[model samples]
Target: MRRLTKIAAVTAVMALAVTGCAKKDTQTSSASGSSDKGGLCASGGSGPKIGLAYDIGGRGDKSFNDLAAAGTKKASEDLDATCKESEAAPDEPDSAKEERLRTLADAGYDPIIAVGFVYTPMVTTVAKEYPKLKFAIVDGAAEGDNVTNLAFSPEQGSFLVGVAAGLKTKTNKVGFVGGVKGPIIDPFAAGYQAGVKAVNPKATVEMKWLSDQADQKAFANPPGGKTAATALYDNGADIVFHASGLSGNGVFEAAAAEDKLAIGVDSDQYLTAPKDQQSHILTSALKRVDVAVYDFAKAFKDGTTKAGFDVYDLKRDGVGYATSGGQIDDIKDQIDSYKEKIVSGEIKVPNTL
Candidate 1:
C-alpha cells in the first residue's frame, strides 16, 4: 500500500529528462519488509532492492497492475528485500517514464520491472543509460545488456475462457470488449472467437473496441466499457469477455445490470470483483504477472538472472482460465481437455482474427 512520493521532484526530473540533462535524486524510500526507519527502499544490501513501475490505472485496477504488485511483493518478502514502486501518470510523455526509471536506478534498485507494454520505449531508452542495472519489461520487449523481457501468450488464456463462455451461454451469441484495437489487444479477441467457434461453430461472436490505437485512456475508461458491454448484452449477448484493463471493471458492472455473464482478463475477477458482481464473473483469463515478476526478482537475487526474451505460454502454465466461482464446474472437464491440447500443440490457438 505504499504510495508514490516526491511528485514535485519527479515532475522536475521528467522535464529535465526531456532535455537530456536530468539530475539524479539521492533520496530513497523505506525498505520493503521493514516497518520502521531506514526508508521504504534503501541501497546496498545483501538482498536485492526491486523497483516496480506500474502501467496506467496502477495498483487499484484490480487487474494487471495488482497482479504485478502481488508478484513483486511476494518476491521482496521471500528475499527480505526492499521494493520501491511507481505508477504511470495519465498521458505523461515518454520522458516522464524515463525519469521514473532513472529515479529507481539512481536509488540503486536493481532488477527494475516496468509492468506494461506502454513502457517499451521508455525502458529501451532508460535501460541503455543504466547499463549496470538489471531491468525487466512485462508484456513488451526491449533489448539491452541488462534487460529481460517478460511476455505472455494472452491468446492462450483468452481461448480457455472463451470455451467457458461458449458452453455456458444460453444464447448462442457472445461479445468481446477490448481496451484498444492493436496487436497487443487483438489476441484476446482472436482467441475468444476461436474458442467460441471450437466449442460451437455456429455460435456468433461480436467484437468491439473501447478506443482506437493511440488512445491511452481506453484502458482506464470504465464508463465506456460499461456502455459498450451493455449494448452487447442488450443486443442478445448472454456472455461477454473483456481485455480492457481497468476499463473491464465497467464490463463487470454491465454484466450485473444485464444479468449476463462476464469473463475477466489478467486476474481472477471472480475473486477480485465486488461481492454483488462476483457471481457474474464466470471466470478470468490469468496472465500470471505475479509469478513472472517474482521469478525475475528471485533469479536476479540468486545471480542467475540473464538478459533477453522470456516467453510464458500455455505449456509453461503462465496463462490459463480461473474457476473460482464454480460456475464453470460442469464444463471444467471440457476446458481442461482443451487446455491439454493447447499445451501439447494439438490445438493451435489463433493469435489474430
Candidate 2:
C-alpha cells in the first residue's frame, strides 16, 4: 500500500503536467537518476520538485532573498529534491509574476516558493487552480487552502539591533535607512526607533526612506541608498541600520568611505560587504528565512508538513541578532542580556510600523 501511494503521487504530478493545466516555457532534464543522495528526493523514491521565485532584487543582496535561497539550497542538499529558481524583474507586473508561478507549477514543481511579500497575489491566484500542488510564501502570508505562509517577526530581532546601535554610538545619534515606506520596511524602522529609545532616551534617530510610497524603484536603487547614507552621516549620525535591500550596499559604501558604522539586516552582511569596510559593521538583525524553508522542505518530505500560516519568532530561534568577526564584542554582553529579557518575557518587542 505504501509503495502504491508513492507511485500514485508521482503519477498525479506527471498527469497534471501532461494535461497542459500548468504551462511552462522552460524545462531541463538530468541524466542522473533520482536518488536520495542529495536529500532533495525522498527515500525509496524520486525527490520532490521545488521551485523558487526571487523578489525584484533577486539574489546577492545579502538580505531577505539570499537567506531564502540558502534555505532552498539546504533543502535541496538534505532532502533529495530538484530545485528550480526564477528571477523576476524589479518592476515586473502582477501578470508577469502570475505567469512565472504558473510556469514553475506546469514544470512539475510540487511546492513553488515565492520569496517575498510582493508575490502574495501571484501565489494566491496560482495556488487556487492546482489544489494538490503546494505553495509557500515568505515574508508575507497568503490565505489559501494549499498555500503555507511563512512570516518572520523581524521586530523581535530589530529591537535587539536597535539596542546594540543605541549602546555603541559614541555620538548618541543613529540613522535608519529603509528601502521604501511600506508595510514591510516600516517594522525595521519602528523597532529600531523603539530599541534606541529604550537604551538612550535622548538618542536622536534620523529616519529616511530611499523612496516615497509610490516609488517602485526603491529596492534596487543603490545610488539612492548611498546618497541617503551620506546625508545621514553628514547630519551627525555615527551609526546607521539599513533595511534597504540592494540599496543597502550603497549605504555600506558610504559608511566605509566616511569612517562610520552601519548595521545590516536579514543576513550577516559583514561578510557580504567589502573586507576593508567590515570594521564599520556593528551587527546584523537576522531573519532566519533559510531555517524556515529547510524545515518546511523536511516536513513536506516526511509527509508531516501542514498548510497554514507559520510564524517564526525569537522564541523559536527564527529571528535574532548576529555577532560575527568580533564586530559586536564591545556590547555583546548587553545584547545577550537583552536577549534573555526578551526570551524571559521581561521584554516585549513591538511588531508595528
For each candidate, what TM-score against the reference? 0.87, 0.86
Highest-scoring model, TM-score = 1
Q: Give residue 18's error in model 1 in angstroms.
A: 34
Q: On residues 27-128, what C-alpha lDDT tens digit does candidate 1 reach at each position?
A: 235433212211333233346788888788877777877787667655544665567778777788888888888888887778799987767778878999
Candidate 2 per-residue lDDT over residues 246-322, each given as its tens digit: 88888888899999999988888886777987888888888888888878878778877677668777788887887
Q: How well does model 2 score by local distance difference test?
A: 0.74
Show where candidate 1 strays beyond 4 Å: 1-46, 214-216
RMSD of each: 9.7, 10.3
Clashing pairs in 2: 39-78, 39-79, 39-80, 40-79, 40-80, 40-81, 41-47, 41-79, 41-80, 41-81
